[model samples]
Target: MTMTVRDLRPEVRADVEGFARVRRLALPFYLVTADSLAYDATHAHPDSHYRPLVAEADGEVIGTAQVGLVHDSPDPGQGYLNVYVHPEHTGRGAGSGLVRAAEEYLAAKGATRLYAWVLDRPGDRAFAERHGYRASRSAHFLRLDLAGGELPPLQDPPPGVELRPGTDFADDPRPFFELDSETMSDEPSDIDYEFTDYEAWLESTWKHPLFSPELTTIALVDGRPAAFSAARTDGGTRYGTVMTGTARDFRGRGLAKLAKNDSLHRARAAGLTEAFTGNDAGNGPMIAINKWFGYEICATEMRYVRELG
Candidate 1:
């Protein structure tokens, strides 16, 4: 079987569909659609140097790679290549071929440090180690059976606070952006990210194909955006919360929880039966909140880093 790696051709519907299929098989927790795949390929920031690669074996895509520089990171020369091979095609050299192509591409573009997320399974960890990558922080993918599980009953907002759908800020999302920027700054991450480009955020995040403004919930304190739970959907029944955070001044008031609960209920009512989310292992507060909402640890991934000359 001849296997080759090449850049994903978004024009070819089959290529995009194959890439999404491979990703879904490898990372079931993620919601991947052909439209989202094409959007990333076409709309990525120029500074990101993003390239989506696919490994094809006899006209079938068996693996995929999302490779790019971290344009938002304060540190330069940092890049990432997240490669995933279909479970049924694991031993066909697809994973290695995709990684090699990604590494060569990023290296030529002046990337000196590379990072990847490998599943917490032993084989996946060994694969990264064999490639000279060392494990760093870990994160977990959590799942909540919205259809069968009992969610915490919704309650009226506390005095001076109101719950609103993210769509309420459609006319002027700047307030939400301000809240997002502040919360993101405090997020636990290996790289420090600064969100100073409002237009960029609007183009990339606000207009993203997967972002669901109607399902997203926001908490307001006397009309001031205090916390939010951002929701994303694949145009299907699957729903996920990509981010849930509270403003610095609004912490410890359970506003974050309030927003997330509202969002979850909205998602369930919208016919989404499964809910997915991710959390850094060190994010104790968010993890506890997820647990309280009946989310269980479904899968784990370890961050791996490698350096290049």
Candidate 2:
């Protein structure tokens, strides 16, 4: 009945595997894999002070915490620590221990405000409330059946608009970075984020292990990056659209939908079976687009916040 919390050791295969397993059981709507777990441990932004943790009982990893600062936010002192305990391991002290450890870690790193995502369930909500966390914003995890559901038939882009794979920009992703930065600046969110550093984006996102250049689709307007659908996969059947957005000038032109549909078609043709994505609960436009694509709301999670004293 002994329990303790420690830093996640990504180099240790068992540790990453156990962490991935726990996440899959607790949050199946999103993508999680051993390779992703290990990659983040090594490639996360250094300034974020990322310190993933795990709570172990009897030498078995039962809970995990993804702790880090809001490195991209212009406002400093913002941090996040998302904790999850294995579904079967709940009721033990693992969840609480991990939360305590995560809070202390972020505080030491100068985090004054903290955010965490808790699933929208009675027990999960109650757990956050007990920890002094206040529910703020909510988001939905959606799933589409790439193997069976009828995806929208691909459509030809309008005059001056062309659809292309992300691989076209493999030689130089600065254009994509510029477009992403613009769309990201105004996405529905509780915190303000600015992707000012191109190098940081290259390290943290463009070259991420799960990003699939071949499956990602971009909508170009007269050879300029206008909208894009970023896809990530585990080199398997499970695919996820991490981001789909149109530049400010093209927001109402249906480019996001065009790019996203192209990506979905590519994923299905590539043998991907399931597609997943998430949208802020208040983001009606994006939610509508997902619904149009036959994505069902698989789960919902609320953003829980607490100010550190």
User: How many clashes in candidate 2?
Assistant: 0
Clashing pairs in 2: none
lDDT of each: 0.94, 0.94
Runs of candidate 2 exceeding 4 Å displacement: none
lDDT of 1 by residue, 1-309 (tens): 899999999989999999999889889999889999998899998999999999999999999999999998788999999999989989778888888899999999999999999999999999999888999999999999999999999999999999999899999999999999899889898878888889878878899999999999999999899999999999988999999999999999999999999999989999999999999999999999999999999999999999996
For each candidate, how many residue pairs have backbone atoms clashing (under 3 Å)?
A: 0, 0
Per-residue lDDT over 129-151 for candidate 2, one digit per residue giving the tens place of the 0 to 100 score: 99999999999999999999999
RMSD per candidate (Å) reads 0.8, 0.8
Task: Show the colliding residue pairs in model 1.
Answer: none
